[model samples]
Target: MTVSVAALIVASPALAQEVQPVPAPEPSQVPLIRMAPAEDEQVEEPQDQGEDGEPASTELPPEPVVAIPQEWAPVPTTPEGRSAYGYYLAGRSALASGDTQQGAVLLQQANRLTPEQPRLREQAFTAAILAGDLKFAAGIVPDAPGVSPTITEAGQLIRGIETYLADGARKANRLLAERPVEMPHDRAATYAQVWIAAEAGDWNRALAAPPADFDPISTLVARSNRARLLEIRRRYEEAENEWKELTAHAVAGSLFRLGYGEFLERRRRGEEALALYTAAIQAGQAEPRIYLAQQRVMNKQRPPATLRYREGVAMSLRTAADQMVAQNANEFAAVYLRLSQQISPNAQTQAYIGQTLINGNLPGAGRAVLAEIPPSEGPLYANARAQRGMSFDKSGMNEEALAEFKLAAEAAPDDAPIVYALANMLIKMERFEEALEILNGPLLNTADQIYEVRFMRGAALEAVGRRAEAEAELNAALALQPNEPSALNYLGYLWVESGERVDEGIALIQRALAADPEDGHYLDSLGWGYFKSGKPEQALEPIEKAVAKEPANAEINDHLGDVYWALGRQKEAGFQWQRVLTLDVDDKRRAEVEAKLKDRLNQLPYDRVAPAVVPATQP
Candidate 1:
């Protein structure tokens, strides 16, 4: 679901207005770095030619520098250029420090100073939209349209909302039909139009023929919208069939199930709703939302009335945001969600907004929204705590992460995800036995993530020296997921080192390597397996490649050093061993590598060095 933006746009759980604003500093005094895209993922722009070798965009480029005033927030009465520079710098600092709300304010001020800076205005617009202030972003384009066409769509959409409220549905429909949103974003406009038309008591738009170039995802979303519209059209038979078809779609399966069940509930079909929810749970789709739906049904509560215009728009944006989030366009998703929240303030939307902020690395803002979900909210409250725990863990606050995870787990003992999260954190801190206690607990015995549970149990058992049980668990996990490379590589590595089945272990790792040839950990396992089998010549190449794949990995480096020593390259081995010490090696590995550096090995150590996977493995 697309989260409502700005539900967490504050720096804390308190209202946004409660925070004191920072004043702009002197331009020369402010030293800030240029903001880079998240994850350093390069987004290529149109050059002389587009990707298909077509001519550059038909739209006119941004003009020469022209300062545009921002009406969203007050700007200091200083020189436009100077204030823009200072506020821009300060905004960059705030964003870097995870204060999204403050950064949005400062960036908004900066844009007011110099909106003609295409990149600068775009950045400010993004921050504003992400803060769930789409109207503010929309305001930027009137003075400086070149800053963003994306926000131009936002402008029209919000205006349509205003028109719908002030005038009537017919006039609003006319205005909304002028959606100039281009491709990629065109679908969002199309969906929004459907909702607005419905409010005008029209179903033609919902059942209309697709545009010639309408995308597949948009088509599917439209069809989902059609299902609901069919019901409104008094075509219950057709609506039921559409619901079945939609719920059967692989991608739409569980996602649409909730909507379908809700539809059933709204029609007063409680038994059908319960059956649907029960079947989903039995099939291992035991999500918190499903359980919540089940609880509501049991209590004989009525579902909400049929979709209103605003509600439909919110749902459309949310569904679009879901696709965007899936594609790692979380920042864009936040924009859609923020607008959705403005139209309708649902807790689900708030949760999604928090998640998008967290995914976008604006964790402080995420925590602000999540903190508002009180304990009385059940699954949502647990999810809020769990999301906060993830943010804490990412910031290296390990203790806080564990505490939050514990709380989430306590609240949802039968919830597999929460339980797994708590266990994973314990395992990260090397509290393996504690992890084992939870993994072995009743919560996940019949859970959806059974394969993952089995694999984790195997690893935890191995850590505590229960090799036989560990192997059994690993085998059982493989039985559940026969092609799972992680289990294959890990068990294979273990078997190779333990001298029980050398060739078989090598083959197992080889099989795992087939899944993803360039995976650093799998490469390391294959190399280490060869080394353990006394074929240093075979080990040399893969180990070197593994080091190249994970240059800063201490364990991979240590493995490379051992391979070098086995192959009689003592000097290079010593150099690699020295390099390992400079990496994030633990005390035990430090001692091992240091000893290997001091004593040139005449032979490879018979004792196995546990690979990184034993703990730091990615499934």
Candidate 2:
């Protein structure tokens, strides 16, 4: 059901002049079919039946999903079974057209009605697989008593993909071992095994021979997966050679192009990678897969296209004008944004452009671009606003950021991440009560959003000084995701701040550090934990690392100054406090640093301060 770029182009020529809408199918045509009658039920054959009273073989094959020269032959209404088959066709049509949610809903309804029909069940399994709901696919696949071996095997393949993605390598290996040595032409299954083996770190198995009659597409996938596995194992030479073999036959619209190009670029073969990425971009358009590939190319220095000026106006500049106010971009990301915009204008591109700007610390510009999109864009609009809010928060404009987060939450009430993000923003603004209300009212009320809601709710409660309630909520979160880093960091930081459970807090921070070694916040928390445990010297290294990673972080700098002072490095501590003042920190924190500096300087016994050494270059 995935629409390839080539297939889209082929379909495009016939769809020119105007975009026409198809008539809605009748309600009775929905995929719902009641289960067939029990086998013992008496039945009567019609006079038109063959000599043995069996249905005639005169019926033609169903129409292809694509448009064709001939009109579809009318199906007989008298046969309920045929009517159910037509519904399955309609469901596939909906799926192929990119209405996957609707298609799956319809297909589910169809399966319920025709539970005994093999073809209907097979169609359902295919629909589920394409939707990436492997668990659902597996459940239905095995229970489909009358389904064909082809479809069941296909479902097995989908399950393998799920296993690989979910990191269930041992189970995946077992499943692969059970397959026949002479595997059938089930490419989906073959690719699933390849993905499983590769992800499981089984490079040898991945590089082995593929099943019989492997299609060209599956061959490329298997080879690509094997190559990627090699790269992971640092067998770069072998991986590069495999990539070379795979690229020659890689599908024009496949996602593998991104992975392949990334590998080539990693190996320092920039020219080859750029060529592959360029080919990928030219091979597809509508799906935006090509645009992503092109964006990657532009990020790596070769512009996706040359910036051209016409009639005294730079086209790229004009595009930027239309888009930038809504989003911000760092140097590298900005390049990707401009190039992607040049090639295609889409919601995702716009969103990414906005995100790039925000992450680059341009809140005002990011908000401007985000605001240009109408609310009718729904989730995309909300996502854009969330990025803008994050930019605002990062730049210390907490009030404005909170407003944007609130709006985003309202716009996407069903999105757990959006709601959780708004909660965090509210907590940052010290509007903990408001955050709690949001979590309790809508986020917690929604069954699908419970875990995230509870986590954020705990954070909000902690911010509001409800320590007991916060601990309880955090405990609940631990039940859901035992080693969740956010919960660990938040609870551990809280304990460190309270000067209680210092050892336990340090242990928790260590656990979080193991999960995300480079996280500045967790590093800061660990440093503070050590400081509280009366180990100032031990705290210095992590605090310095934290400040280095997050150069503009006010709290970390303050903490570093505290640690230096505790260690009796008076001159160095004084310098850190002065540095904290020079940064654009909040007024309250700046006042505290200024007061500390004044108190420290007054207590110094030295007649005069040492002359500061100047650096040759300044940031």
User: Candidates' lDDT values, in order?
Assistant: 0.73, 0.60
Candidate 2 C-alpha lDDT tens digits along 140-217: 763333233434444554455445445566677667667631222143344344445554666566567655454343
How close is each model in CA RMSD to the real structure?
12.0, 28.8
Report the poorest 10 consecutive residues by lDDT, candidate 2. Answer: 306-315
* lDDT of model number 2: 0.60
The TM-score of candidate 1 is 0.69
lDDT of 1 by residue, 22-55 (tens): 1111232211112424544444432355888786
- What does candidate 2 score on TM? 0.40
Candidate with best lDDT: 1
Which number leads on TM-score? 1
